[model samples]
Target chain A: MTTLTHPKYGAIWFTLVVLLGISLLGPLTGSTAFVLLLAFGIAVVKAGMVAAWFMHLAVERRLIWFLMITALALMAVLFFGVAPDVMRDQGQNWGALAAGKN
Target chain B: MIDLLLKNASRSGVEIDKLFDLITFLVGFWFLLAEAVLFGLVFRFHRSRSPRALYVSGEEKHQKRWIAVPHVLVLLCDVVIIAGTMLVWSHVKQQLPPADAVVRIGSQQWAWVFTLPGPDGVFDTPDDIARVNELHVRSGAVYHFELTAQDVIHCFSVPAFRLKQDAVPGRLIKGWFAALEPGRYDIQCAEMCGIGHGLMAASLYVEEKEQHARWLQENAAPPRELVAFRFPNP
Candidate 1:
């Protein structure tokens, strides 16, 4: 039996904590775009760290890597595909345009 | 059969119905075919008075092809469905047609409040018309709504219009539809909010322009205690 240990684990934990702290301070900036970008970035980094280190994907075989990449690509496609509809300018008075047509 | 499924009152409702019919037909065909094949295989491969049974691990080239072919076909079906759905979704949701009116819907534990632009035709104004549990709009006109929830999450759904949107406490959602026919439709709270969720029902009246104008003139009065509610920080 063998036990594996890495000195980088402590560094990764520190980085995750720092990222979380930054995300917590995101709302104070009062900039929605900035907050959203920072939060999502932190989430992605944290998720990547977990998948690479905790889940041992860094040492996984080529087949596992291919499957993971395919899954991620599909998720990105789905998100981008649906984002256009939900992220429209709601403040614009579309009714005024319709009234002009009439 | 189509009429039995919520009456289509909006122009876009027709498109939605067409998409739904296409999906139903494809799914029904696939379901029947798959079930028939499953039953046929079960009967054909049933164990009878046989001396021995053949053991196959499906690792052979021929066996692998059988699995791969079906998998490819299933992937093709998925691609077709996704392509068709994205087209309709982009049309209905991404592209906003000219709207004749826009209203704000505020939902709480057990009630729905609709805010219509006043004579000035703008919301967040002192003159804006706010009604409880009654939404009035003109037929043959495109209408947009801004949805928000005061407390818990709720879903504003009108079956006849084929529209549903979530009202989140800290987020504003937009939804729109155009009514081609004039009638009274039911507005339901599709998401459960609280114990009073069952009572969270409203009425949507779509009438002729003249009739709708008259009704608005008679009932469009802003409540005295119209508090400006702001979205809470998450």
Candidate 2:
């Protein structure tokens, strides 16, 4: 965390509250896609705001960014690598997932 | 196997128990060995015996051998486990034999409603017998159950049969079991569905062919206006 600018916590909190309201009300549109998009898209923006301003990662060194990205990449690799075994409903030693054909 | 103590009750329960035994043995062996090695090392290199700090980085080839040997051995054990899992999955989940009797089971928030093919040996007619929290099946007969959730996700679990299947909302999951003995068993909702999930229990009756027929005859409804069974909100 090495941000040079001082953050206005009040404004940030106000923005987060507004985003939370929109996410909560997104389902009222009756579109699953819209609800999901608004919920997650706002979540991403909120997270970035917290990390960049509150956590003060905006002015961090390039090396810190690289390290963080590398950690995220490793997590992705671990998740995706095990996804096939986790998701598939095919047979293995004793049994497979209880995934039935519709 | 745990089934040795529980008395394996269904066709698939035997194989499932064997798999469970293999896993238990392997994991038990490894667990004991690891604990022994750790204790042995700790006792040998105690502070009272050796006052000087002896730091081992585990960078040397010989040091790495301890990790390597167990790594290979554990991998082999993993292979055995995966192989066993695949075989059972094929038999239980992947394959569904032709059913001697078909039952429709609907899971609601707090109860199970079983629709048995009535005396005419058919479903959805005026004679379909819908009972709450009770499932009756003939022993020695293969049964296919179409499981569905009325409102929320639930699990159809019979521990005696070693059967567990998720009853997801908007899905008809078909699973089968061949009854072995004529007895009564407990059916439990394995998944958390609502405030009353812990109370969502049922009874499974495995009756002889003749007994089941008698039950069907005794409970058979006369031809009348068809009415679907629905649970009032819990």
Candidate 3:
């Protein structure tokens, strides 16, 4: 019955807390893109930590590994499916507005 | 039955109504079948003498209902529903409006500013009136609003018009709506701003093209003269 009280996990959680605090304050009056990218990167790191420790995938059975891999593949497919939407303009040309030249 | 089902199935918003109906149907169908089996087992396998409960580990090929047929059917139905939703979403997103007019919408502190290109294809002009909490548009016309916020991030939403757009500081997002009928719509702030978020509301008036123009002209005051007249050094 091992609990989630490990020092390494504590460090990771602390880092996540700090990152979240910074994210809350950064986007308010400072750079928005920096805050967004940092927040997203922190999320990726946190997800990795959760998968490695909380789920205990490192010592799990082979079938569980197969299921995790399949899920990841499906997620990848979904990501690619919606990639065009986030990347594509889809609307009017907002380049001039973005460039502060409008 | 067909008429009733058709009437029940015809509601807007997302496709939640039909999905709920389908889910209810599937769950009810399964519950009835399971209940019948459970009742039959209770009646047939009644204990007349000292009888023990059978312990059956369903691991073998014959014992295990591998790839449960009903579960597979449910998964297939979910996939079909998701695919159908995706198809509808794609169609709605790709359909470009024929007469879409771009309008600039700005949110600053507790006020809303709507800028319209005053027949000259230019936004900043004397004719442009900065209204605090009102937006006027013509009915049956696709109006695209470019949303931008000054202080904090705010969301411009009108539920009746099915419109929602985020106004981020230093960035311009967009939202569009086409009113089928002429009426007054409530424009509410969907995002949590500062203390005045609850009070952040505006009015959207959808009228005929001619009526909209006439209303703008009547409500807006004439622009002041640039040169100031003064009597100095007398």
Instruction: Supply the DockQ value of model 2.
Output: 0.05
B65 in model 3: Cα distance from truth in Å? 4.0
Off by over 4 Å in 1: A1-102, B49-52, B124-127, B223-234
Most lDDT-accurate candidate: 2
lDDT of 1 by residue, B1-234 (tens): 365866788877788788888778777787998999998877777776444678999999999998899788778877888888898887677777777899888899888988888667777666778888998888998887777888789999888878877787656666788888899999999998989989999999999989988877776576665555442322
Q: Can you list the residue pairs that collide in candidate 1?
A: A95-B99
In terms of TM-score, the best-performing candidate is 2
Clashing residue pairs in candidate 3 are none
> Chain A of candidate 3: what's the TM-score?
0.53
Instruction: Give per-residue CA lDDT, model 2, range B30-145, as digits (tens).
Output: 99999998999899879987789878899999999989999999999999999999999888987887889888888897989888889887876767888789889999898988
Instruction: Work out the TM-score per prediction.
Output: 0.68, 0.69, 0.53
What level of docking quality does candidate 3 show? incorrect
Deviation (Å) of B35 in candidate 2:
1.1
A-chain TM-score in candidate 1? 0.67
CAPRI band for model 2: incorrect
Better of 1 and 3 by lDDT: 1
